[model samples]
Target: MSALDSWHPDSKDLANLAKERLSQKEAQYILDHCKECRECADKLFETIRSQPIVGERRLVKKQNWMRAATLTFFLAAAILATHWFLEDNSRSGQFAIEPKSLPDLSETIYAEEPSTWFEDAFTHAMVSPDGSKMLHVDSLGVSLVDLSSGEDLRAELLLDFDQVMAATFDGNGRIARFANRRRDMGWFLESGENLRSTAIPLDAVPVWAPGNRDVVWIRPPGNRIVLGEPPDDRWHNIGDRVLGLAWDPTGAAAYGLAMSENGSASVLRVRPLGGEVEIIREGLDASALPNGLAVAPDGQSLFISLATEDEPDADARHETRVNRDLDIYELEIKSGALRLISNIEGDDFWPWVAGDYLYWTHNEYDASVMLIPLGNPGAKPLFDVVGERDGRFATQLPRWNPSGELLAYTVGSWRLADWGLNLDTEVVAIGSDGDRGPPAALVTGYHADYTPSWSPDGRWLAYRSRRSPRPVPYYAGPDVTDDIFLRRADDPDAEEIRLTDFGWEVGDPNWSTDGSRLLFDSWDRVPGVSKPWVATIDPEHGDLLDVVPLKLPDEISGSVSGVYSPVSDDVLFIERLNPETQRLWVMLAAGEVEKVIDFTSYTRGGAAWTPDGESIVYSALVGEKMQLFLVPRVGGEPQQLTAEPVNVLHAQISPDGLWIAATRLSQKKEIRRLPLR
Candidate 1:
């Protein structure tokens, strides 16, 4: 073999390169040759392509890439840039190009290890049965992407991508099934080299029987399970209150988890045609039950990532924050035997049973997708590196640049436990490109900074800060209130221009289309009351012109936060209908009203407008995690994005409309394995 052909970095080198443990001396030699020889670039690109890495692992930009050796981090940094070249992406997106350099990787480089398939926030990735393809679903829609080529083989777009939920690959891997929140099922199938789809219009999503169209579904409200074929009216009741569902590889029987009214949970194995339910395991702890399930290839075992049975202790007299501890469990189908597969402190969830291994999301200080052997699965080692959240610092409300290169978020210190009383909070930003890092400090000081919004020109950023000159009286006692302020994005020492006056307790700010104004709401602590306000600013000078309250139609009631569109004159805002429900409404510049559908979420930072102004990206609860979703500006179905166990507090589209810079609330989870022997 030729020396140039054989001397290439493998996956291990790439991982080590990402962690900056790879030898930089050798890495420099390989890349210097790659720059001059097209053949060498091709060989290195092939190795980079074949690496078994997925999920978002952003490279840390360092001076070493330009000064010293070409490290293996270039292998990962080259991943999307190569795809961008083949696809000819417009302008600049995240990882469009790497400066070619190496080691000294930081925690920010691989902080969020998520799907590498979709560039934006991808919620779910369902690999095919043959493991040759993945059903890529995100806020945009669903597409069948080739695993090797990174090409979209098939796509079935249905408006907002958030509406596309609960997607899975069928037994043959040619057909895919998906459902929307409180909507019907839509089928994406491959027929004679063509992609086609049909709306099932059923109330609940149906889990397909192994090799056929027959499906088993759990009805809502009472959580009743039913056996039926789509497009037909007749259905047989299988069971009720199913928590999770799965089918055997042989298609002989189906498995489900049932939780009773008494808070007891059980696992049931039901015969498909006859609807005979056999209780495989009963009286499992109902608390922290698993949200997903998978059956082994042999059809003799089932796996689940279950949370600890103990409930989180409630705080004495403040906002309640539940810290749920999760682990993995396995059950033998024949013997009705149950075994704990994982005993880690962090969360190990979303188990997918493959041939001889079980893969899951392992999260601790950082979240990663990992797998372990089914037999003799030794204890999976915990992530030794501590994250920013592992310390007193925890991030919330992340906003990113349109290029996906920079992320701006709030970092605050939590004493005892975060009850929103931390006064050490500040707005900080990080970069994905080799930009060293974001500006030293966007907004910092004794005053707490929150809700940062970027300007259209990327020159100025607006945020809400608790920097009132005098103490404002909160409900309980006197406390520093919030006001709108603007700071230059590129300058750390620039004087911030205060937008709102001293008295008003302002909300988060959103810049106008031309960067001439900001839209926000006042009155943060008052419940059931939201008043819209606008602050005018000069795009060229970054000076606050004036601040005024906006008048709304009389019919629009409830606590409404004004979220102006980035690309249009329309005004988009969210109104809290109740403690559980929120209504998204859009008002045209011509005084016409359009009401979007209502969604439920307790953890929210208000809705944000997309770059195109056609859809608004927002977050709502999917299971226990807060994920990003999209609703059309004109009013239609909302598409959901992001499916990790982590919560996305905020997300926004970039200037070029090329990326969705999501601000994920700082969280960590990892996948691990437990022995079944």
Candidate 2:
């Protein structure tokens, strides 16, 4: 008080006061005098501002109590903030403050419910022509995301409809068009504006004309292309066998691919509004059916996605078609010269051209958004939406903002028709004879349960259940920690017992011949990388017995898929010599390993032991489909079992060895979109 009352405090002293370094008495003395002295008050104010605290400066007068109170409040707040800053910086001496910048474009903007699974069809997303908003739709509903406000403005619209077939936005993004489950087409304008609804054609594909002048869609019954607004849209019957459609960027013309009357092949045709129809190209390959079409910005060329058509064989078990070999081609409008654009290994479709880049979606193990520079032959993927092989999960539909600064796509895995990584599997048992009563479920629940194994006595069923939510490297359906579970074989409703809890993934549990112990594969902290070890568990009490490592040659490091021999004390498993080669091996309980079968030419799944244990049944990719094959335990020419077009993921012999139980799968996927930085 003595120093503050007689002389003005220095700048350092004022800074310390704002930082709460001065005693309470000294702080109060300085505050009291600053209200009467404008020069000293301004100095204290500048000192507080320079101290890097968040607050505003206030003026005070000797008699103004409110102004004095405001000043006092700001000083206290600034001091508290300064204390926290200093404390944090003291712990980390290298702390630094960086100026804020624009949001990182590399980061992704995902949906509110960012799951790993999706519905059967493609979930579409589009950006407003003005780039101010984005529209996303799926089985769940529709969402209109406002880019500027970072808010989902049209969440209420999603609740009003059960399913939205498609959605498009006007040039300004203030108006939106939607086709819903009731075959009704509607427009939603800005808040306080009236919403318009009317009946439209069902299962129609909606497209917005350039500049949002009018809406065009492919109507059914005659497969005619319609133009104009709902209830008054006019049909343009250019051809009867229309396969695909595209519109010019200026909205002056439309293009379509139609099959010839003879049905031998397809031809490309173009028609200007109210103008005569003209054939652009003819005699296209019939086996390579056109699935998607898009016109370049200059309107001089068109891009098309062609999928190899499937032709069923007379046997009803085989279909001749290219597996994931869809290709993209470009056609010049004037010259009518068609050239291939993408000749990759996967199925490419849904083309969109913007600026100097051509974007499309490719589906293989999972779907990916890909792009290539215009006039450049090489193409690369930006990211994987869904997958298991390489840390990719399900994602679809990618659209670019008009400004081209942001991109949006959807993320979720699409389940296969019968079985896939997306479905929660159950265990069912049927009679060995072809004729029997209705099959019954042996193990069923909300959780994913599969890979069922019957104990030697057939009294207990050992299966894997994904109960814990842990993020796995691939297969992004649900966070799964696969654990072994046991249930009564005879009682479907009986309470199940948990057999193992090692905090690691465990699967393929097989019982010993006597039903006393269980053998399974687990990826624990082993010495070598990419190798899984075999572990034994007591079937009676679920206790870990021991971990047996496969001592293989130096070139052969990885081993997995272990199953106990029903006839001997040997463990049969798959050993990998490299990424592309794997062989079946039998490891004796007495510590010796022998190669049983070579799987170098084809990819293989889990192998099953027959009732007599003389042979093994496994699934392999022979040609275009995954089929079942049988081979003797000692190894020889493999015998093909099932030649169906479907993939046989796993096969097991019935208890009586009369019929084989197998898990069959067929897969399909659609694209989606989300915000990208």
Candidate 3:
């Protein structure tokens, strides 16, 4: 390199070699060829002086060539040094790109190590099968962890990704499955197969079958129980609009839960793959259970938990109807008999089977995870918790290991636990060891993070984040929008990528049938002024593509709502009808627009398509309260998804298309989930 720049590696090596091979004087002579070339320089100068005798053009050309070569060497050296330094800075926790957004979410989430806010706000997490691997899906991507060792397994499985919504473990837990904004499902194993994915049809969500025999996935006609069969075109709809399916190795028959327009919950028993729809229990008043049916091993009994109106709350912030109570019932599928189990007087939901015991989480006065013994009429407290009765943290979901030996749950922002009042939500694990360890902080930061979904592989997790404590404005109006984030399941390192930063506010992001993309609605503005824009997002990179424009602005300002098309790359959007009512419209990837069937009168705010992509599911305000509706995507009269009008909103379809998980309004704004079946 020239004197203007640093030394070149080749030059340094040459000098060192000379020093090692020659005597000091000789080495100096060899290395300092330029400095010692005064005679040669003089000869060159004399030649240049005689350039007039030679040619001006020749002399100028030679000088230019020498200068060009020297400059090139120096420039190359500078570039190499800079690249090396940058790489080192990134590894040392110093390099960062000043993102486009003001008050970048990325900076705040990864601002510190073992960050208090991000750590505690873990809304979702996926634990691997052997219980060794764990994955945390956040803005950054999917974080893998070795749970047995409590160490980060990989820095990231996906890069620059956001909206990791759901994750699970396969049979052995060696492979982890995930679903993101795209509603696509992905599987990853430790071997060579990475990013092995089976796209859940845009119409249905796929859930793992018992013992990994097949996956209970959704399609147009009904629910499909797909075996461990490699993904192909084979999908069977066992029934018309089959909502929920549960398998108990102890039971001779599998049970399904369904809801009808008559405000009745029906329990159906059938064989594993394809069988007769035998109604075990019918016409049970109250809607479907939040958590699906739980069957005992002996097949003699079944437990179904459902929600109902309790009493009025005078202290409620909103001027609305009174609260309701949730009840758990034990029924004899064969004898057509039933008896009440809990009826916990509050919001009861999330039922799971653990050995001979039945477990569930409910919100009576507050959130609590309760347990009941199938063999014993009365059982002492297996576990109980009190959580925030307001905000996203108010309604909570508890998770249980497949073995049922370990029970895991979350405490919301306002939760009052034995360990003081939790200002942020915390994820805690309880082993059968009777030893309840300290709460493991999941997500933390300036926002309220909740609604965690675990992947099948147990190697990754997905969740959503909400900006909490209200905004303390530094600017006049908000410039950037709220998005999703991610973290490592084992390590303290967390990174957040932007999912939505458009001018409009986006909410209720759902993963596509596959894990690669996310579906969400971009609300134009506040209610009464804006339309919902249906948008598709890249979960790994937070890049959003406007799939459906609600109004189809002539040049600049249209709106849309809903998410991905039930079957194709197309999207479902709600178009405004002269600002009075909203209608369903389908926007294909090719930019083709077609109006579908009407959902209901003045349908706004919330909408979704059934798992099979054949039916359009949505929530509409009927009279005073909002009711659920399911209509054919091709065009048809809308069918009610919910019977009673209890102000239901923010509803989402599970991968299996068996249940509708949503936040329902009861007493204290409880979160309730029910079977679509």
**Angstrom error at residue 222, model 3:** 4.8
Task: Give the candidate number with the greatest lDDT.
Answer: 1
TM-score of each: 0.41, 0.38, 0.32
lDDT of 1 by residue, 505-541 (tens): 6677877777898988876456548778888888998
Runs of candidate 1 exceeding 4 Å displacement: 1-122, 149-167, 177-200, 230-241, 259-265, 282-290, 309-325, 342-346, 354-357, 362-677
Write model 2 residue lDDT over 216-287, tens digit each, in one string. Answer: 667554346676666677777755456566677777777776654333234344444555566787655422
Residue-level lDDT of model 3, residues 550-651, one tens digit each, is 444332133444466546766777655543356777766776777775433332445666657777666666665555677777777776655442344444
Cα lDDT computed for each candidate against the true fold: 0.54, 0.50, 0.42
Superposition error at 405 for model 1 (Å): 32
Pick by TM-score: 2 or 3, better one: 2
Winner by TM-score between candidate 3 and candidate 1: 1
Candidate 1 Cα lDDT to native: 0.54
Q: Which 10-residue window of candidate 2 scores lowest in summed lDDT?
A: 97-106
TM-score of model 2 vs. true structure: 0.38
